[model samples]
Target: MSDTESNSSNRQTGIATALQHPQPFEESTIFDEYREIMTRSHEQQRQIYSEFKAFTDDVASWVKAASQFDNFRSRKRIKTRLEWIKAKHGEIEGVRREVVTCVEAVRAALSMLGGITRSLKGFSGIVKDEFDGGNDSDLQEPRSVDCAGPNQACAK
Candidate 1:
């Protein structure tokens, strides 16, 4: 399709912007940052999941401590059980701190994603041509390809 028609179709369909898409072999620094941002986000996800698992494990330990405390009390071994309970409670505090850290990590990841999205809205981004055929004077004309027809560019 013509450039104008292609741009119009893209806008109408809301499928994408008028920004020229790069072919697979093309590379741009912005795209590199995009990849890095996504990579960090994935890593952060893994860390968060690991932290959540640790938190769950800590919670299970605390539950087990509580159950043991009740049994120990019934057996009149309350003093030993009390000391263990105090230590387990301290671990719960550590779990709380880990949760806070994970939340901060998630927030940071989201902020990075947002920043990258804003960066994508600039130069290597949507252009006036998307809205209207603007300043295409610099664009090269579409050349006839070496199609296997008789009137091909490479007649040899």
Candidate 2:
């Protein structure tokens, strides 16, 4: 056979082997742990969002009520209390700080979740392609086909 024909035959054989033995998706213990952490982070984000919304809504209601009231002294007192100092003897400042931290954490979790989702999307077709009209046995051993020997496939 010519060199061109030999290369074509090798390519065809490698492709057939790869199609016949696609690997199944296997979730490791570490992956399960990360998934659990992500689930908890998602739930915490919801709770923090609710708490932050409620805090803001309460402040808005106070401002609205203070404005509508006919008593000037009461309005002043309410507005004065809204202005907070971290050094003062009050827990509102600390709570606000914690809310900010929670929001930051939520953003971080969202980034991690996006990466995991992308990875899962890439693997989404693997299981279907592995099992569709093939792999007759339930416990087929995983097989890998190397089209190129060692690192010869790399251009570098």
Candidate 3:
């Protein structure tokens, strides 16, 4: 067979295979799976928040200790310590912003999913209510950030 004919034959075979073995999850099942994934993500975020909090606390303690020393050695140590503290503070800030962004994204996604669910359920009042006074200002705008600059680590 020619190259074009061979390519068409392969495409037809692929389509036939895909049709024979359809996706296992229905629309509702897919939504449930997504919700489960989000739940796990939330748990991971909580752990990250705790870890970062502890790290920030440790940095704060070091800063406090560095403040009490007056010797030349302490002065030298303080310089490096301050730099470390500053870096950590930046990391903390980045994580904070990331958490905020993730929360907003999740909220938006949930809102969309809620709409889909309502539509699927044949609820007519939801759309009207959403437009009337049920809308939240916080969900209206998503916060954005630039993590490509120097010293900017994109928080996962």
lDDT of 1: 0.64
Model 2 spans > 4 angstroms off: 1-27, 70-156
RMSD of each: 56.0, 56.0, 45.9
Top candidate by TM-score:
3
Better of 1 and 2 by TM-score: 1
Given candidate 1, what's the lDDT at residue 139?
40
User: What lDDT does each candidate get?
Assistant: 0.64, 0.64, 0.70
TM-score of 2: 0.28
Model 3, 60-125: lDDT tens digits are 999877766556677889999999999999999999999778767765775764342222222222
Between candidates 1 and 3, the TM-score winner: 3
Q: After superposition, how far is residue 1 of candidate 2 from its true place, in Å?
A: 77
Give per-residue CA lDDT, model 1, range 81-102, as digits (tens): 8889999999999998997787
Q: List the residue pairs that clash in candidate 3.
A: none
| Order of candidate numbers by TM-score, starting with the best | 3, 1, 2
Kindly give the stretch of ten consecutive residues in candidate 2 with the minimal lDDT sum.
123-132
Clashes of 3: 0
